[model samples]
Target: MEKHVSVKMINRFDTCSSWFHHLTNKEMSVKRLYRTDACGNRFCPICTWKTAKKNAIKISILMEAVKEIEGKEFLFLTLTAPSVSGEELCDEIDQFNKAVNRLFKRRNVERVVKGYIRKLEVTTDQEKYITEKLYKRKKDYYDWRGLKVGDPNPTYNTYHPHMHIIVAVNKSYFGNRDAISKSEWLEMWRDCMNDNSITQVDAKKVRATETSNSNAVLEIAKYSAKGSDLYHSEAVFDTFYMALKRRQLIVYSGMMKDYAKKFKNGELDRFKKENEDEYTHLLQSVWKGSTYDSKLRELTQEEMEMYNERAKFIEEGDEVE
Candidate 1:
């Protein structure tokens, strides 16, 4: 019923990667297969999963860096106001981001938390969306024709947008006598938003694991919105595109802001080590719609020599005289 890019999105996903290269070392072990032609579309399920995994790894690197520097602590915070309609979604998010900025600017807030990373998430309510559509007698319209929104609780649900935040702090934040309490945080958020109706706020310490990475950061590194929500209907999809397109969903503040710049410079990014001396060759595979048909074959002597020469050239990074 609405103008959307669903057709284009479907086409993009259908032809995401037609070929995959399987690489193996001299040890005869398959190093993971390589498929680099991903469409990189945010809505593509395949690309979204890939992005999430990469982000999780990069964020873990950041957490590990923090851990190395005197064992800094982390806290996962969830702030909610109220759901808004698709029409109001974009502006609502703008206000949400502003309120978060206002909260961080507070002397009290700045005193305890060191740096933070924030992620914005928008979700749609399919069941309630349809039920309400009929109730409002929307005559085959699009753009959430007569959707009811702004209700903290709804019969089904509406377009619910919220923030998932992770704040890094010093070790003494929790043990100090002047530490902030749970109720105080709720009040501060309400004041920042200028909406006393904001009652559902959650803040908790990130529990430590044997690994350097904290599990709480995964919540921040995940997708900006649920795939199920967008694929529910054209209206939902269009609304999300309009609301989130060109918006900065991930945010870093204070000391974390410096880390963000470092991240892009590859300082905090993770890369797999490739050994050129191992003499690895690639196995070619072609996609047959659902599955990849392996075209495995032992390399001929000539092919092996070619692979070695290419690897040597790459390692040397110079042309032969």
Candidate 2:
């Protein structure tokens, strides 16, 4: 990260979550606030894990709610296209996204799948199409491939961009004659892509089991791209940065859209309170959960003295790390 990001970013990472502000209300309920670092991208393992976990929770909420409705079916779908060179990655991603849009718009797809949580994942493979830094990408704003005419990043690999979608439909979808079988899914994808040769897809009905749901959710909500791929080389990192920087990795549509919007807008009130930082102080918190364990009551004489000293330093602009 230091090599790729600015010095300011490095400094932010250094102090991130180092001193969490613990806030207490009149009721003595407490919540801790951790500072967000500049390294909030997928490259940061902390942020990636947090994001994956958050998405899992969000999906769980949606799925659990959807399951309450009668006659709902869930399908885990994987759609793929052939691997592309780094030089063509951006265009390929654009095309893939457009193809997905077209597929969703098709009458057959829209008629069956009422709701969906769509996620895009990109993986790199060196074994199949392994090569050196031989291909020069059309655009390299950072010149990650190096300035020298012959010199480039250490290695290069082909990229596979695919979709992991979880779609919900009515129960009749399984029995309907026009139901989307594996071959039908492939046909739809192939037609949408306008490529007859491209035919890689995996679609399966998800059993309404806790383990099955958990597995499907994890597969869909896990990191969009691997951290290993990002750190492979400057060239590879740059390719990812250009290809995915501003793109939405996960999307919620149709029936799922309202739930996602509710989730995002804090209809889920815990989110607003939990994520918002009503920064208080270097809280004298031995307080555990909502019970207000130890920190809620009056402090001992020694504890009071320590708190005073700390508060004094803070007021004097001499904060102790």
Candidate 3:
């Protein structure tokens, strides 16, 4: 399955670097380093990596900024609804977002859970996630949570589209008479969605003692969905791609407004710049986009060497805007 996905991805991004200009200065001396054009296709693995890293850094900084506030606690919440076919996938995602926004706006909810960061995630139905473990001999490879699988195809069966939210709450929340219980949270979520048919909602405290690696905030700060899952079926991938067309994957509330602005305004070192002399001469290897026995191949060795010899490096201060 993974192999098939890789083949498809490589083919899809075969022309990613079809055209690129070497980093150069006003003097036209190219730097040793070069960058490929990000295709910006949502399901494209390469583009997704670049986007995820940028989001992670932004989220981490926001989390740090808010941690200094008193009475702050984090909760890992999962909200889900019934699966939808390819036709309904896009609509369902929009509805999901609306319902979540409604859940947060409720008077009772705002008193306790003051702020939140929500991320959308999708996984293969139960059979693909659960039963596939039989193929692995190592027990550690199995998913121990014992989650049930659902349909594999988005066109026919229900495809799982859910949100994993890192909710911030006041430390004194439980002391209030109106504080909600775990079950009540689930009920409220169901009611907000206006559909009591699907009953899977989770809300749990994310302890402050937890390590950054295990912290719920950092976990959901990652990619919106697994790349492998999107590779399952083109129909499913298309469904998600269309649904998330203009959607914001991760969102922060209240205190994060200023932090978001700073990050977006280039106040952060989102992308590392290579020192001027990191490499006097660097090899530039890219796909030629020509077919070789029905497979895309990198530039020939001679082509790479010739290009490297002609490229010139410039001083750091001379970098072009």
Candidate 4:
């Protein structure tokens, strides 16, 4: 019997490999916070968690500056193309990124889109799973070329690469002459993709105002692909790791570029000043289902004392590593 396995679910069977946490207390509030350093490696699940937290902060800061503009709005968009085999995976991502750049350059899209942040992502359709018995019984039938799975085409069981973009547009864009509706956005995406291989595409307007909610923007800033989705298959992992080598996974353009520069110039102080009563700290966490366990339970007396000492140093203007 052919066993079905999910590429996305393989991480459920794996445990967190790294352990180290840091905590901090709010300046004017009693709230405590925790966070950890992210290695920023594409294949590390533990680091993926940390990266998501860091990215959320970054996107939030950007949105803070964005909301300052009078008529600007945000749109969360998912852009996709045809799935390609492992061999073609690397090149396809490059093509997809180039196409996205071209997409923004178009008069129709450019007229409405004032700025954007884009990230690349990938997924696989797990066709079949091989059992030890089957491998031993028909050892000659399997090979690294994906032929062992029955398809002679070595490129079978391909990787699906796509982009999740957060676009900033003028509030008037929806009613403008070049305004793109949900359906029109998809068609424009296909036209930009410029490949017969592309058949499925999607985009929708998301709430990104000052009052509604900003979680949508934060979600768009998360990792290009989940660690769970990439860690199961060696072919997928290696291909992606090499393909994205030296590639900029996230990009910001237009007025966003200016804001990003300000952020790089230590704009974190702005966030701290704005949210003085909030705590931002590190934690030792275990990845659960949808989120990680970040709440600090009970602390030993010694640990509590150490935390207090560190907090005192931070309040005294001494940098704590």
Best by lDDT: 1
Off by over 4 Å in 1: 1-13, 25-29, 129-157, 210-214, 266-279, 297-321
Worst 10 residues of 1 by lDDT: 312-321
Screening candidate 1 with a backbone cut-off below 3 angstroms (N, C-alpha, C), the clashing residue pairs are: none
Q: Which residue pairs show backbone clashes in model 4?
A: 33-281, 34-281, 34-282, 34-283, 35-281, 35-282, 35-283, 142-148
Residues 198-278, candidate 4: write the lDDT tens digits: 555666666644323365655565676666656667766676666665778888888677777877786544543232332
Q: Report the alpha-carbon TM-score of model 2 versus the true structure.
A: 0.68
Residue 304 of model 1 has an lDDT of: 62
What are the clash counts of all predictions, listed in order? 0, 0, 3, 8
Off by over 4 Å in 2: 1-7, 14-39, 128-156, 211-213, 265-321
lDDT of 2 by residue, 7-112 (tens): 9877766554333334334454533322222246566666677778667777876776666643577888999998889989899999999999999999988888
The list of candidate 3 runs beyond 4 A from truth reads 1-13, 17-34, 69-71, 126-156, 174-179, 209-211, 265-321
RMSD of 2: 11.6
Superposition error at 116 for model 4 (Å): 0.5
Q: Best to worst by TM-score, what's the order?
A: 1, 2, 4, 3
Which 10-residue span in candidate 4 carries the lowest summed lDDT?
312-321
Of candidates 4 and 2, the better by TM-score? 2
Better of 1 and 4 by lDDT: 1
Better of 1 and 4 by TM-score: 1
